[model samples]
Target chain A: MTDPSSASLSSAETDDGAEAWVDPERVSLKNVLLPLLTFSVLLLIWEAAVWQARIPAWLLPAPTVIGEAFADWWRELLTHSLVTLYETLAGFALSIALGVPLAVAVVYSPVLQKTIYPILLALQSVPKVAIAPLLALWIGFGAMPKIIVVFLVCFFPIVVSTATGLTAVPPALMDLIRSLSASPYQTFVKARFPTAMPHIFVGLKIAITFAVIGAVIGEFVGSESGLGYLILVSSSQSRTPLAFAALVVLTLMSIVLYYAVEYIERLMVPWATKT
Target chain B: MLASSSLEVVTTAGSIDRPKAGARAVTKIQIFDLYKTYATRTGRTTALQKVDLDIRENEFIALVGPSGCGKSTLLKLITALIKPSRGKILLGGTLLDKPSREVGIVFQQPVLMPWRGVLDNVLLPAEILGLDMTEAKARARELLELVGLGGFEDRYPGELSGGMQQRAAICRGLVHNPSVLLMDEPFAALDAMTREDLGFELLRIWERHRKTVVFVTHNISEAILLSDRVVAMSPRPGRIEKVIDIVLPRPRTLDMQFSPEFKAHSDEIRALIRRT
Candidate 1:
């Protein structure tokens, strides 16, 4: 507990104010190149394995065949990707429109916290996949149903993370503000909300990833235009490469959406996220 | 509480910039027969009992005791963050029933928001207090410079060492120009050298700002070093055992801690605490 040598070492190691770790935001070429290199290597390996095995495209398409499907079906692929993107964005917007206010209401009112929070937990536990079919039956096969699924998937995490962030203020800071005789509004604006920003971003990132899966789930249950629908129709027709291409689009969509959230977090909560 | 021999040091020891000691100062705070009880799982438990003290304007007092001795509770009570079961506090001749604007607080932790830069962290109190931002920014910058965190204003708390963050916290506590600065073991989390350095830095800040400083600490020597009087408290229905008037020279330093009179006061406090 009282090691003088180690204490001196720790004192010596302190940078005063400089961070010791590698900056997360630092954009080194090696960082970009390493991931790109690995992905290319993996794709090349896949191409070699499929060619050596003489595997049918219907069984498992090689990367090149999938690329060909992309080239051939570019127009249809763009149309489906746009449909999916619209649903994802619409649902995500709806989630933010509702989820953030719901979080604030729940955090402020104990009655709402006790009542609404439990209901949310109960509803959330019933899988979104299970609920998608019911939603489709009730709402019919439209973008509305797909967007609703995305909304359901995205809303809970936003509410939870926002509520947690709103309440997660350090007790000491609470005391400091209290001692200042700060009004409740001042307390929230100055202390509570900023504290919650980082946590809200945490929930937002989680919900963004979930939003894509939700849209896909909705399409799988019953839809005609989204990437999920393309995958279903293509697979049924034994056009495995087309299905694989749809998957590649969905993967890219998820990555782009996640990075969008990450970028916004950097802008909005720079102090929390910046190295 | 002071030995007669050190009366000379007590009066003339302050920096020439600060006012001379030994003149009777106006009473800044009056605690009257205070008692606090908590509703425990087993039943009601008394946290503090029969506490009574007078804090003079611009006087630096330290509350020193072991853990669970209710020193922290007393600070909260003084801030009016919590209420006493019986009796009351008068802050600047006003009844202290709610969180008072007359006092600022420095908690054990720096508690700086990681989302805010050091300047903005110090500016929080001013913003919450609804002071003029233009003036507050000026005062905040001045405080940061005074605390030797001059140029690191834009850095986040994560970038600073524990000592630096605590220094920024001290600036935050003073930015609103509150008459009373209630510190609850503010440097306890810091290393020994940093803690000592901060204690002296605090004295420097206090000498200029002239707040009625109520500093709480478990460290006996720290209490004796920085304070004009050290309030020794005891546990199990915590109450003050003695108020040892340090009577040490103004603008206290770490070197004073090893002096014979400082050791005498330290040993006196240790013996009082051990008696419980």
Candidate 2:
């Protein structure tokens, strides 16, 4: 009785297993090698064009000049990078602290959802860059304004993603928990929160990238130190290579932070990755 | 010249005999005058009407019917997942108005938390009920082992096959050791072969644990195989049509399915459902 079905299922599973075995190796090889190769080729072309065209350093710095500038001011660049990173991390952390609870409240209470969701949407629609100068006037040219701008920029995605995650729990799973006579709090912790982790991480990833941009915007408007401030100072001084170096550092920081979030996501919800 | 003779005919041919072992069985769940009506945007629709049933302790009963017969609704009502609209459900002689820890349930889908491993999924009920963690963990392990998933404790639900996942779900339902276990077509999603395998697996588990089970299914042979009595219901204002006692001996094997007695019972139930 078991033979026919078991045989069919086993054959199907073996086929899947064989396909899965080959996929990861090919994907990893392509993911790492292709990006590196593309970046190297692009950099070589940029360097060759600068040499061939004999472009002035002030107009467009070559890759070699940018590298030289990065090496010369490595200490300064590191300090400014640290400042920006701090702002991004702090703002991201604060958003998670405040936004998740707000989302939970919105999800659980219809009255709150009705009253608060529209206001949040309206606030989010207003461009945060337009308010940075006003924030600088209020908080002065310090890290606080940058932090506030980062917080403002990143808060909406967290709230939206968390709320979506909480609401997206399967009805059957909810029924299972409810059937257990679980309290509302128990239901949220055990069923809703865990189920929402993947969605929440998605929001976090998007918000992290935006946070770096927000911090930079804050610095551009008014700040004495930071990668954005460095870029502003270098450009005003006509040190184009230094500005390029600062931009590279900022891009690298953003990439590193995004990947860190993704790494934590994989750790927190390994089951999500498999499917 | 005798006047025209009058005669009365009596036959016990189709009369349902309550399983002999049930003579001393205590009533565990008393469902009285149950009525359910759903108010949709269109209007009120009656889901179930004036249903009455008494379930004996440790008796495995199957509610068999066509789709839309409110069989799943009945399971929901028992678990207090939904209100009956008009009747009383008494568990152990006490009126049940809300979900109680004294009952456990399994749905058509396994519904195992994808985030949880097999053992953790089984311990979910215990954790919710605030039971002893050490004891519950030990029981979870044992239950997993009982379902032939002993070494799979660390595997996530996604890692398991559909049948294995459902088995884990069943283990979760029984983890708390509730007096009654309710299943809503738990094996309906499986292929025929897996369905049969799970049916026998369920029987094995029931034999060992002996909890009062009210299983809902549309499969006639499945009902006959696993249940002590099969309650047939009609659709559109779902109501009980008839109850048939399965007098087959204990520890039933798959080979017994081909016997003449089994065929007779299957034919009888099929005919009854066909008429509905």
Candidate 3:
């Protein structure tokens, strides 16, 4: 006697009334203004400390001296900075390309997971920096060594976080999909992968920071170009202010990459429940 | 048995007296000699034992039992989500070997994909079913409207209230137009008022579609109110203890809940549930 189809159909209607998605406005002047003001205040304090304390310039150059050095070598440092950025981005992209598919493969196949996981853990345990010299010798001094080092630093977190996310689906959630009689492939595409996005972003964010570090490390041990090379040159010549400027630029590059990743995470996973 | 013609006349009269529809079809679901056991590092533990049941088509049956009673496991078995250690499940006179598109499931949590909007979550099954996306989206909109969640089509699951989220989940389950809806305490996370509202809404929908539903719930009152038959279960090597039939009239209302018949059914089911 019941019209089961209509009942289910209208119950679907009941849900349609509650959804409310809105476009959040983008970052505005107020956002940039606050941070800029804070940075200025910090700079002013550093300058005042140097002027008042009369600290030896060799040990800790004044803000004015660092600023002058930054201006003096702006063109040269910018070129090197761009090279490092290019290496970092390429390495990060490569890590994502390799890591995500590998994570998926591991999640879907237990045999592959069992054989590969322990090996990965052991590989991660080996200090990557210690292997940098050998890698340089093998690959030579072109971009390859630096890119490989960056890839090494950035790949693990992506794979680990992505794998965790894929596997960490709650049992109840799986039940919801299972009862639907969803095919294994359907379940993965519709439920498991989407659920893993936020976790993947976490891994990517961490890896990006380390990617920059890896590129710098590659330059530190053996490289003809990059901010790292500039650091070596400035430090050896006892141009501490120039070294300080290079260091500042390195920190700024890392921060920019970190924030860029964070921004992408926000865009890609706005509905992240944990956040 | 009543004479066929006379039975038809009687049913017609009974239906006229009622305000809503009745079962649209009879779906036979049989669980014969079902057994599930697990061998942990500690030892062997049985989850279900000698469970036998025959569910007639279009019956809204509620399974109520203690934790670890294998109620969820039973649902899993029927849906072919897991292989029974030894047993058989028959739907419409055919053995259930794999998960079928004829069944829709709503789990305890909303479990809506956080990255998908409300409408997209509801359309998930359609996507999986390889159904037409445009048609599915249109149907999804209608289903959302039925649940009183209209105009919320674009919102993410995180933006919805608990009750609202569950409502969206229910829409997702029913969207694929499956013949059977399996709910594992789908409203358990909701507040009392929301639970009551959803219970009635679910009944209204069931009345319209008459799909066979097997609901798992811990709430005695909920089981009594929603089910045509309440299957009471016992824990550890879980067994079906009793099956109590509700003979109350159709289009059951909140007022009937206060009537003697409703209370008697509730009390009897509660007593049976506590016996274990």
Candidate 4:
């Protein structure tokens, strides 16, 4: 059947000329502009409130003061930010390397799933922040503790998503491969894995944001470096503006990393987005 | 009387009693008292019981019945996707234990890999079989062209219409040059016009290839239009009630479906199915 919606959409485009064609672009522009405008208004009100109330800089710094503090300590902040970025990437990579195979095993073997799935769920239920201190105690205060903690935090989501994805093959698709007398390995490599890619990416997206939090928590427990440590030191020293600057940098980093996963997902499995 | 004994007698007698025109046709598949029982959490349900059929080479047979008549179960059994509880399936006089390369299957859904383009999807069996990729690619291209999807080879499954995807799936089932093609309600998901169009396309392909086809469908007209034999099945404890031979001549057209002979065959099968 001719798609009624698409037929109407094309007709609307024709009737409205370039305007209908540009509708999505216009919406995207509004999306960005509206958010920025709201943020600017909030910042203006905060600045006016701080100034009019004669609040001390140590209590609540104005937006301009925070910006100036960010510029003044940009070099130090960049160094600490790089440290946090490294820990996040390293831990996230470790999670993928370990979690995927574990997920595969869980999906393929009922024995392993029955035995290990509960353990994983239990482990995930435990507050990750509680384990950070133990990890720091065991691995020492270097990058190792931070990386391990990040790995621990990111591991569960990847494993769960991967397992779900691997097992979610449609019965029809499974039948298609099986009717070919395909070896189990061939079935997995060609059909199951490719089908699971979108799901795996979803896990990666969630795990990545958690990886940032994990790294920061690792820093909070022990690390002498990283943006988390910078925030800790600045706030303790009553350098509120510098702490806000470090927090802002950390937020930007998390956004960048999340999008990076999304970008790769688009490249690897473009077909998934359409479905 | 055991179905297996009768099946054996029929297999030998049919080969010996072949007419001069049918002399070259040999038995391609022989099912001896095949039975399938599914064991669920509750208990066991018999899907097919005491089914016996002998399929000739290059013959087109259609399995038609009400829903849950084990038409699909029989197809799966023939393809060796699932094991039969009791019976022997012989391919060219050899006992079949697993999915054989000589048999290809098309399910109700196209089941095309969304990631792979149409050409790659058709070549999937070759890849799984580890055949020569270069030759498989050439055959894939020819099959695509044959199916009227000549220029759409590079397109993904999502990009194609439902009918086009099913056509591509049919090309996939035939790409390996299998001797027997098993289709389980392949066009059941398409619109009426698309189904008719695909039916004609399938007949054209069968005319050229002459592969033994075992098609399962609920549509009585579809069975009469495309098959040399229509096997009517009973529901629940699925059993072959009757096998009606269509005497309609080859290269059958869509208009032939409205003919008096075709109507007689259709009515006869419908009555047989309704009786039980």
* 2 versus 3: better TM-score goes to: 2
Q: DockQ values for all predictions?
A: 0.41, 0.47, 0.33, 0.42
List the candidate 3 regions with Cα displacement exceeding 4 Å: A1-56, A273-275, B1-27
Tens digits of per-residue lDDT for model 4 on A98-203?
9999999999999999999999999999998999999878889999889988898899999999999998888987887887888999989998899889899999
Candidate 4 displacement at residue A11 in angstroms: 15
Error of 2 at A264 (Å): 1.8
> Which runs of model 1 end up more than 4 angstroms from their true locations?
A1-42, B1-22
RMSD of each: 5.1, 5.1, 6.6, 3.8
State the lDDT of candidate 2 residue by residue for B8-100, as single tens digits: 000121223334453566779888888999998999888887777777788888999888788888889998889998989999999989998
In every candidate, what fraction of the native interface contacts is reproduced? 0.66, 0.60, 0.52, 0.58
After superposition, the stretches of candidate 2 with alpha carbons farther than 4 Å from their true spots are A1-12, A15-27, B1-23, B271-276
lDDT of 3 by residue, B1-276 (tens): 112322233233322322335634343687777899988999988998877776756778898987887898888888898888998999878899988888889988888878888998899888878898988888888888877888789887776777788889999988888888899888899888778888988988887776889999988888877877778877876877777677677766767788788899888767765675
In model 2, the clashing pairs are none
lDDT of 3 by residue, A87-164 (tens): 889888999999999999999999999999998888788888887899889988877888888998888999999999
Window of ten residues with lowest summed lDDT in model 2 chain B: B1-10
| Lowest-sum lDDT 10-residue window in model 2 chain A | A1-10
Prediction 2 TM-score vs. true: 0.91
Of candidate 3 chain A, the 10-residue stretch with the lowest lDDT total is A19-28
Alpha carbon lDDT at B70, candidate 2: 88
Displacement of residue A96 (Cα, Å) in model 2 is 1.2
Q: What is the per-residue lDDT of model 1 for residues A128-155, given as tens digits with 9 covering 90 to 100?
A: 9999999999999999999999999999
Name the DockQ score for candidate 2.
0.47
Of 3 and 4, the candidate ahead on DockQ is 4
Global lDDT of each candidate? 0.87, 0.86, 0.82, 0.88
